[model samples]
Target: MIRMENVVKRYNELIALDHFSFAAKEGEIIGLLGPNGCGKTTAINCMLSLLTFDKGEIEIFGQQVHPNNNAVKSRIGIVPQELAIFDKLNVYENIDFYCGLYVTDRKKRKALVEEAIEFVDLGKYRKFVPKKLSGGLKRRLNIACGIAHKPALLFMDEPTVAVDAQSRNFILEGIRKMKAQGTTIIYTTHYLEEAEQLCDRMVIMDSGRNIASGTVHELQNTISTQERIEVGFITEDQTIEAQLEELPHVVKVTKRNGNYLIHFEKQENNLPDLIKFMESRGMSYTELSSERSTLSDIFLELTGKELRD
Candidate 1:
């Protein structure tokens, strides 16, 4: 549904996008992730033609993107990171106003607005104003406002940020429903778990460039750490850290609080080896859990920074 080729955007001396390129297939949810100041927003703005780039091309629906391309713009919905609803307008009114921008017919728009409310599960709060809603409810209102028009393409930036767990789950579930309805979504969030849970494919951006792009499993395989074992002992042993790091296939060992996180390179028997070593030393741990690599681990390994940073 969307494609960019060797796109470049600069701000004075700094490069916001350096030959950056990306693509999204129809009806797929794509997670765009990066550290702070990596130009994820800049790339989105350029794709929307809200910002002009110095080089490269951007196309949506096989047509070039431009500021005046209302035909193309009309098919895209954007739910910004910050709440973009009116505080005075009630939930229904806010949705009505935003949806009205695309749908002029009052009767048709009314149905759409109602559907959007139900889609986000905000029917009970229809008459409530933005200020009267909880953070999560307000987020739902924001999503309803953006998607009430039922565009084929959606851009959701941190839509679940700061919301309660239930609300976040509601928002994520709603996104899945949108995808099931065949909407192609471009999602950006600081939360790796959300991306892993919600996105079909993901693009990791860093230094204003697309460093990696693939499914969660494919991206995890790109990194050396194939497995991670987290163990908590009855007693925190300072000397054990170095010993664990020296174990076979153990790439690194880190201690946080009272738990030990052991990262292992691509190899089998990582857990059995660790358990054997522990039993040999007569060390009994209170907790021993093993899991494969996560998106966050791959992210940190590739970017050398936290998802939020």
Candidate 2:
């Protein structure tokens, strides 16, 4: 439903996007992962024609995207990283105003506005203004405004930021419902767990380029690091930690919370073999848990563990 071919954007001398190419298929929630100055937002803005690109082509629904494509744009919904709402307007009014952009008839527009409010579970505060709502409620209001028109394509940039856990779940669930209804989505998020839980496929971006793109498992396998096994034995043996460090494929071993946490590298998960070895060595564990590499793990591994400016 959306495509960018060899797109490039520059701010005077600094390049934001350089020969970047990406696509979002219908009914797919593709996570756009990256750090600051990585050109994620620049890439999205170019696709939407919100910012001009220096090179390459952008198309949505098979039509070239330009600044004044009203017919094409009306079919898109955008919930930006920042809140976009009128403080003076009540919750219902904010939704109505955005919905009015697409639906001209007051009768149809009113129904869509009501549905948007219900979609985000904001019916209780329909008449209340922005100042009276809590952080979560404001986030919900921001969502209702963008999606009231029932667009075919949605762009959600950090939509769950700063909301309560309950509200975050509600918003995430709503995204699933939209995907079920066959709307294409381009989701950008800092929360890796949410991306792991929701995205059908993902793209890990950095340095203004497409560094990685694939399914969760596909991306995880790209890293040499695999399963992390933490073994907690009923009997505390100081020798156990030293013995585990001697095991094959063991790269790092650390003790925490009265347990041995072992990290393995370049090994097809040998947790079962480790268990057998521990049994033969008389090291019995009361609790054993293995955690597979998550998007966060891959992210830090690929992007480095430094704070983004």
Candidate 3:
């Protein structure tokens, strides 16, 4: 439903988007994962035709996107990271007002507003103002306002940030419902776990370029580390740590909080090898667990450990 080829956007000496290209299929959620200042927002703005790019093409629904293309713009919705609803407007009123932007007919707009309220499970609070609602409820209202028109393509930017777990789950479940009903979403978030849970495919970005793109399993296969073993000892010892580094298939060993985390490249017998090493040294562990690689590991491995501003 969307495509970008060699998209480039620059701000003076710094290039926010460097030959960045991305695409999303219909009825699937594509998680645009990246840290701050990695060009995710810039790419979205350019795709929406809200910002001009230096080169490349962006097409939505197989047609070039333009700011004046109301025919195309009207079919897209955006739920920004920051709340965008009016504080003074009641839930129903806010949704009605935004829906009015796309749906001019008063009767149709009224129906859409009510449906949106139910869709986000905010029907009981229809008359409540934004200021009176909790953070999560406010987030839901923001989503309701953006999606009241029921656009086919939706852009959700960190919709779960800073909310309680209950509210987060509610919003995530609501999003899944939207997808099941055939809405294609482009979701952006720094929360790797959320991306893992929600996205069917992912595009990892760093330094304004795509480092990797694939399904969770496919991306995991591309990285060197395939397995991780976490073991903790009763006491820390440098000699034992060195022995672990020499274990079969062990690529990296890190110690944190009195636990030894061993990273291994794709190979067999990784766990047994670690056990043998510990036995040879006559060392005992308080905890031992084996697990496969995670999206967070892949993200840090590709983007580096340095903190982003």
| Candidate 2 lDDT for residue 249 | 84
lDDT ranking from best candidate downward = 1, 3, 2
Residue-pair clashes per candidate? 1, 0, 0
Candidate 3 overall Cα lDDT vs. reference? 0.88
TM-score of each prediction: 0.88, 0.88, 0.91
Tens digits of per-residue lDDT for model 1 on 1-309? 999999999999999999999999999999998766788888888888989999999999999987888888889998987789998899999999999988999999999999999999998999999888999999999999989999999999889879999998999999999999999999997788889889999999988999999999899889989988998887766788887887888888877667998989875888889899998987789888888988888888898976642
The list of candidate 3 runs beyond 4 A from truth reads: 234-238, 267-269, 276-283, 306-309
Give the lDDT of residue 231 in candidate 1. 86
Q: Candidate 2 regions off by >4 Å?
A: 232-259, 265-269, 283-287, 306-309
lDDT of 2 by residue, 1-309 (tens): 988888889999988998898988988999987766678778888888999889999999999977788999899998877899999999999999988888999999999999999999988899999999999999999998989999999998888889999999999999999999888899987677888899999888877788788999999888867777888888877688789988898877877787887888754647887998899998878888887877877887887754231
* Pairs of colliding residues, candidate 3: none
Which one wins on lDDT?
Answer: 1
